[model samples]
Target: MIRKIKLLLLLSVFAIGTAVADEGMWLPSLIHKLNINTMQQMGCELSADDIYSINHSSLKDAIVALDHGSCTAEVVSKDGLLLTNHHCGFGEIQQHSSVEHDYLEDGFWAMSREEELPNPGKTVTFLISVEDVTAKVLENVNDDMTEEERNKAVRKTLDQLTKEAKGDSHYEVYARDFFNSNQYFVFVTETFRDVRLVGAPPQALGKFGGDTDNWMWPRHTNDFSMFRIYCGPDGLPADYSKDNVPYQPKHSLPISLKGVKEGDFAMVFGYPGSTSRYKTSYGIDYTMKVTNTARVEVREKKLDIISEYMASSQKAKIQYASKHARSANYYKNAIGMNEALTKLKVIDQKKALEDEFTAWVNADQARKAKYGEALGLIENYYSDVENDKAREFMTEALLRGPEIFTFAYRVKPMVEMLKDPESNKDRIERYAEFLKIMADDFFKDYDASTDEKVSAALMKIYAQETKPALQPTCYQEIQKKYKGDYEKFAAQMFNKTVFDNKEEYLAFLDNPSPKVLEKDLAFQTAVQIYEKYNEIRNLVDARSDILEKGERLFVAGLMEMQPNKKFYPDANSTMRLTYGKVLDYDPRDGVTYKYYTTTDGYLEKEIPGDYEFNVPARMKELLLAKDFGQYADADGKLHACFITNNDITGGNSGSPVINGKGELIGVAFDGNWEAMSGDLAFEENLQRCINVDIRFVLWVIDVYAGADHLIDEMQIIR
Candidate 1:
């Protein structure tokens, strides 16, 4: 068939070429073909086989994609001891904490196996294998097919391929796209579900500087947490079970007590969530202008609403801590990223690159035919900044900004199931029970007064800032229902909606009815917002299709134009290896930052009464004791944190920072404030990866927490 011939034409293997140090989230499996030489030449002592060999256990085995790849964790001991960032495990920690047991305020340490807490929904997945399945995926895809048809073909291939790959096997399979769907690969993974919390330093140590110190350099956050995995007696994945045994990992990284030095080879191995180095200039501007601004503004208002309640009540603080932290993180990141993008003139750079690309395309008939419309299509789509802003703010304000909308959206699905004419009673009852459980979790963290204030404020912004026509029908209903008084509107919705009152909410589930649900205020608001959401979405999706194809061709054309320049795919929440060095830099004109920070810096930043900077008594005593046991650096001082030039992003948090010999020396935690724009453009000198020196993590574990049984499990290096 014609499809078969097209598939054969595209079946050529991807070969390894050179790449830059500051960019690229390279696939581990392709290290043997693409990155091995550069990595070795840059002082990597290990061979490619040691990094990602499929036929043997390699460094990849020690790394795990935590909870569907939101973050990364590393195996540190044979008995499945896992180490990750405190914030990554903050949700679980918060789940276990209460007014009586304030673990967030005063950390948790398990002295015995019985003391460790089990997390029901928590899971850790290990990469079993990765193989390219691009040819099979694209066999049915052709240049003449519509984008939707092509997408369907690819999806079908992926589903079929995944089914075949996993066929009755315990392993889960994923067929992920690379380079904007230009290439494809299948990843097989084993997920261990019986994950338990082993130990964690109190918030004082784990989140030392709090929000003020999140993405900044010269940092002093003890941003690490500990957990353990349990599996069946046969060493396979299992759900939480009291009888399950500790999982013996395929490989566990050996902890190194010796700390990193400036210019030392540092390589981070983990699942980096995403990056857009190849994103079209349209995306960059859309984000930099309307999207980022909308995010920062709306989140600031949302934070104000939540923080008022969180500040006065201990229970609310514990309940909303994770939610607040998650929201505030990207809120701050957006603030800095907007500033960095403008200051760095990244837009200019992108425009220049596109300029050259246009000239290159127009220089030849064949190139013109292939890439002629790419730049114009991108530029023309992004030209409508007002409409883009309207679309973006509607999403930020109505769809995502308010918390109530979350439950409202979910209610729609349940309502649909209720409306099914021949709905099974048993199925409906089970669904009803599930809704009850969901309501419990929602109300446990819900404060209607706070959410009402937030919803009111954000809805005002949505109404005023966006075009009147672009505003959701809820806005018009607010006018007709409550004379545009947001507080009155929110009050009415919350007061009447079954969602706010728990008992009433669950009672309705006993005999769920479509007629009653349709009249529900919250459900009606969800319907109106979703309707408006789709209208704008249709407007965006039409342009997005053109942008997507243009971008795909732009990237391919860019690679061809500069054949000598090494190319790598963007990060897509898959396992990748990015290598660099432990080096400090001058972030601004006259100031220079050191490569590492010690416990001395920790004490200097501490304030007795300040919640963000308060130092604990034991921590001060240990520092004054002038001894770190065996966890101190070569200079006999305890290094709390260190800096690296390793390229990383959000999901790389808690990733293992390995030395030349494949030893875990630190955990990549944060990036410098100077390079908030690193994801858009890699700043070779200013962009630094902030990591917690493994020495600090171990010191807190073995000495501060006195969890020797946990420490004894690890293969510690002197």
Candidate 2:
């Protein structure tokens, strides 16, 4: 299964020895100093100030962070009409969906303002500014201080600084560390709480090819979704209200129907989440062997159970669509990432880097005193992998696997609240109300039969794979009482458990008692799982300080050793800019993938009856007519999706793919499967960012869905 031969055949380069051209997610504030000249040389017509500036309107004003960097969106209309990926907005879409409405199947479009759907917790965050506060945050900590004391000092400083930053403003302030706590920055942001769902295409169009096409090239998925932000008459953020009006943003990106070509300048601006490009080889090995492998095994089984039920019922299809897609997305990524990392020999390359670092330290006594033990610390910690494997299996197979245990765990706070009702009367009342909301949400998507099957298989897997001592108390009870017959035990538990019905559960909460909860099988199982989880966590915690300090020192030493190389800080859910040109790649010896996919490609891949490939009759008719309107290229081909070499990660989903003139061309949604290892090490030639072209987005909106009224709000250029 090792693909080193294929790797050698495809790539002439041995391994990613260092950062190469078009790498690094540079901070927007530092673009002038770091990336502007190179970007212009590549084809960019915009200046640094045009991309990011405080005194005037800039591209940053249009880019918004959704739910604190979970995804990105851009303003496309003067009235705050927003555009992001279908998958990014899937949760809200699922929440509004029902068996009757079936919004996920037949998409929703708000013809007017009154028809728009409002989501409760959804918010669009705009970055006002960021300032370095490292010296202030670390002012009270010392090297000699213990980790606990150091944390306390840092928290106190951050709290004070955040308070100073907020003042009388309504903006939210966040201070986060960079480079494993070696640097820090305070961010000021304004968040609009009233975000309304405007339009989306049906899954047949938006999620075309679903899991099979995710993270792969030649994608035809029109992954875009639309939303709008509303503000008060004063043009400030406000909660959802009838009185609120459409927000007039400082800037909006113009959509260019003039499509992307090979080697065209492309830039992505978004809030990228975490990446451990500075991780030690030991850490990479642990991820590959334990974490990634465990996920691959567990999620595949989970997906099988869900997929079976989803195929049989439309209810299951809507309920588990989000959950299934999430699990499957990472499942494929892990399988591909493990193979890519091994084939690329990233671990060996990292070892060579560390060896050179060791030599550099040995040459100087002061350097040795500072960094000599960093690698040893990492090695000693990772040597405990034998202990870590069982913990991973137990977590994946038991703690997170069963839905009943997870639901029962929610009652832990309610149990404590009932214990002292007189002193916590108000809190208990509030929690009871919250319990109703919780039940409504969970049971909407709950299929008890599916969970029962999943629980039985996972329980047996946990029993078979784990050591006797590592198994939870519940497993021990299973062995003694049921003789390890998970099927019989699951049947009894599902039939007898109060959690199987919301009405019975709520009736008990009306006059809850500790004895009632103590005898509950689901609650009992959850407690045992948590007890073992804490045991493993404590075991890991005992050695974590050394590991943490070692990681910090390793990055510091790497920066020192390669002083001439331009080093960008690792992403930590902060805004960044990565620029590259649109290009194609050869995944294998005889196969070369084109940079862009077209409408004809969509018709070519249809499977007739498959939901992933099937489309609406209207869409097929439009394609047959070849009436793309203004969204086709000079060659008269309708481009659907395209690729660029822009450096991006998970949180960059829904980010705006901007052209040299600061016009929107696409929305980034996924990364290529070949270089899934880019999270650990950047493979410059193989790594690619996948985007849905803006032209295809509009084509689907205006022609396929007949939502041309929504198109009237945008500034589109032919």
Score every model by TM-score: 0.95, 0.95
- Note the Cα lDDT for every prediction shown: 0.83, 0.84
Candidate 1 per-residue lDDT over residues 124-225, each given as its tens digit: 999988888777777787778866788888899899889888989999899888766777889999999999998889998999999999899898889999
Q: How big is the positional error of residue 417 in model 2, measured in Å on the Cα after superposition? A: 2.4
- The C-alpha stretches of model 1 lying farther than 4 A from their native spots are 1-19, 385-388, 417-423, 511-516
Per-residue CA lDDT of model 2 for 591-676, tens digit only, reads 99889998888888888879799877878899989998899888898898999999999889999999999999999999998888
Candidate 1: residue 101 lDDT (0-100)? 97
- Which regions of candidate 2 fall more than 4 Å away from where they truly are? 1-15, 138-149
lDDT of candidate model 1 versus the reference: 0.83
